[model samples]
Target: MSDVTPKHAAALVALDWGTTALRAYLLGDDGAVLDSRASPAGIMKLPAGGFDQAFDETCGAWLASHPGLPVIAAGMVGSAQGWVEAPYVETPADASALVKGIVEVTAANGATVHIVPGVLQAGAMPNVMRGEETQIVGALAGDAALEHEPHGALIGLPGTHAKWAFVFEGRIERFYTFMTGETFGALRDHTILGRTMRATAQQDPDAFIRGVDTAKDAGHAGMLATIFSTRTLGLTGQLAPEQQSDYLSGLLIGHELRGLNEVLAREQSNLAGRTLRLIGNEALCERYRVALERFGCDDAKTVADATERGLFRIAAQAGLVRAAVRVN
Candidate 1:
């Protein structure tokens, strides 16, 4: 642990600890971020018995600065492979359900840690989501328009496995997952298409736009047949090698947007014409926005750092911390 002094007493500590990275945030009494620390100690990065040691190394100083400071974590840190398996909270539920599902552990020095639960949707096509649930909670909690929307909101959290949640009132009604980003990665790094795709293939706007158009035109019925066009376009001398990556990105994201539109239309009519509030990093959200606009869902907005907002709300609701911010 680095020897440093905290400028402000931390009201609580929040973590958006996931599969590949761990980010910690120190927040004040008003739920505003104060300071933060980070580590590469994602669950996958730690050894069998290293979670405790890693936590101590990363946040022990903050803990020392504020004894018994409540720590609330969300993401794969609560997965079966994490410190403790915080079970899934069923859908058609609210943030209260998340608070109810929290699983805790005690550090050797006696600090308490809370792991937020993932959300599960059970039905013909079941779906599960972890960190994204908290992002959704924070997004809704931070936006009064969304928090009080009469028709509810459609939340799209784009990442490796993008999650589309339909939140009505204050509860998450249901959600679906699209492995769009992961699929793009696989195609770019492991498949034959990668041979022609160089690093310069990213941000090729023309190729990406074409890919989105192809996905929309193909719809779900022809999706299985559409991806091959990435290679065929190159073979036919239509797609340049440098544009392959961007093209592939467009095709997959297009497929995701199209699938989301169809699923929402079929599953719930109330979502028609409503905007999708996107929660994620700026780049991915922009990509989704382009596809959504091309696919006729024009109003897509982005909310950065929803993960932090959510951790604060969950901790406050659970009485793990006292923040003056209102979360309804």
Candidate 2:
């Protein structure tokens, strides 16, 4: 058993335990992903005392093959409602800070698990994020140029709650969240606006562009009135029912970008010429890029796989992996 363990002992297991899904990666000692698997055992789905069984069921084979497999997890799995409530680390912090805030727990399978803490921005307008922090760490590590920039980099992560962050010197100076996606979801599914909009897998770029343009022209002050235009356009025969959803999507995303512009202005940072690094999946990042370009920020670049790389980087910083081993 000991000899078998040494043959394919994964350096560590990285888990992205989010609100609705759980993804696991078996990484080699050098930070390369050896094998991966996932399950629907997200924290939200677990009943009382179910996390241990769920985890063991998901990765029991790997755990048995490599005794005491060190597991590092990020995302809502560390939230107050997660397996163990990992606390939040304040901003102006870096990857090291994230590693330091890790909370350890013994899983039902007896595997040593470490949960990465979320990041918080305190004061008048308080905001917090859980899993996104690890992705930020990975983004900065992947793009070294952003860390040394004198003015810092503006990173936009689009999702349920899109995050706009200011990173400098390998630390998150401050960040803000916009409920653009969630708002869009609610309006499309629960409000009258959804009734007039058709659901289709293929998005209409033309309609989306029109919405982005309108949003940029209206600015932040016009958001209240701008959203109403979704229904008004359809009523007036200006917008097709099938195009309404993409149009609304553009409008909300535009609002988010415009709001971010305003925040950057207040902070005296220029978004006109600087290249903005957008970290997320290709589809979402493409939408943000389009909106940003329409809003006069043309240098938006999308990066994929930042989350996986981030998990590896954070694990290395915590000295969790000291040597390489084969993984089948």
Candidate 3:
């Protein structure tokens, strides 16, 4: 709790705990943030005392001050490696489904922490997510289009392992995961592509767009054939060492979009008129916006405050928070 948190304004303590970081939010009844805290204490890198200490560091004081504050958490904190293992809710699920899958863990402070479950898309190409499901809930909590549109919505949460979730009538019908950022790191740090690349403080937009254009024009051969150009272009003096990184980034992201485009085409649709939103880092989302514009989905916009809003939304769904009064 900081000086910013006004006296007794918090209605819920929400946490968005992930693989590499932990975010704690003190939220109001209306889903507004009253105060917040963040730590590098992700699930894998907890300190000597582990999850209890990590939770206490950010939330212990708040709980002491405001006894019986409703607490809810999302992300890897609820994974198999986390404090408690909440089972996965299958796809075509909604917030209500998440409520049905909630698991309760009594924290060190004796306060019950409700853990939100992850989503599993099972079958031949099985996929699972823990934290991103909460972000998706945050993203779609109060969107207007999802209320009336049959076409639904698409949200892109870009990161080391980027997840693009598809929502139709408020249910996550399906989604895709792209290891673009992780693969980019491995290629730039471990692969032969690292041999000719230099780190740059600034991004090379021209080189990045060049790689994207190459993908759009000649990518029918797929990424395996195109990624080699990152090295050859630098060796031939066509690309500077500093530019190769972003160019490779563009190449990888371009292929991702290309695959997404293929998926859309299979559904008799394209990015041209899709209702899309991006919920993640602003700068990375900006890069995605640029790449997406090139791919014809020009209307994508980044959303803010979705995590806290999502936690509150699910809390309300689970009867942990009182609903706001509505009048006709």
- TM-score winner: 3
Q: Model 1: per-residue lDDT, tens digit, 78-179? A: 999988899999988788999999999886667788999999998889999989889988988757657665657889988888888889987999888898
Report, for every candidate in turn, its global Cα lDDT versus the true structure: 0.83, 0.84, 0.86
- Which regions of candidate 2 deviate over 4 angstroms? 1-9, 323-328
Worst 10 residues of 2 by lDDT: 319-328
Worst 10 residues of 3 by lDDT: 319-328
Best by the lDDT measure: 3
Q: Indicate the TM-score of model 1.
A: 0.91
> 155, model 1: CA deviation in Å?
0.4
Q: How does candidate 2 fare on TM-score?
A: 0.93
The estimated TM-scores of all candidates read 0.91, 0.93, 0.94
The per-residue C-alpha lDDT of model 1 at residue 73 equals: 94
- For lDDT, candidate 2 versus 3, the one ahead is 3
1 or 2, which is superior by TM-score? Answer: 2
Clashing pairs in 3: 75-131
| Local accuracy of candidate 2 as per-residue lDDT tens digits, 107-144 | 87778888999999989999999988888887877576
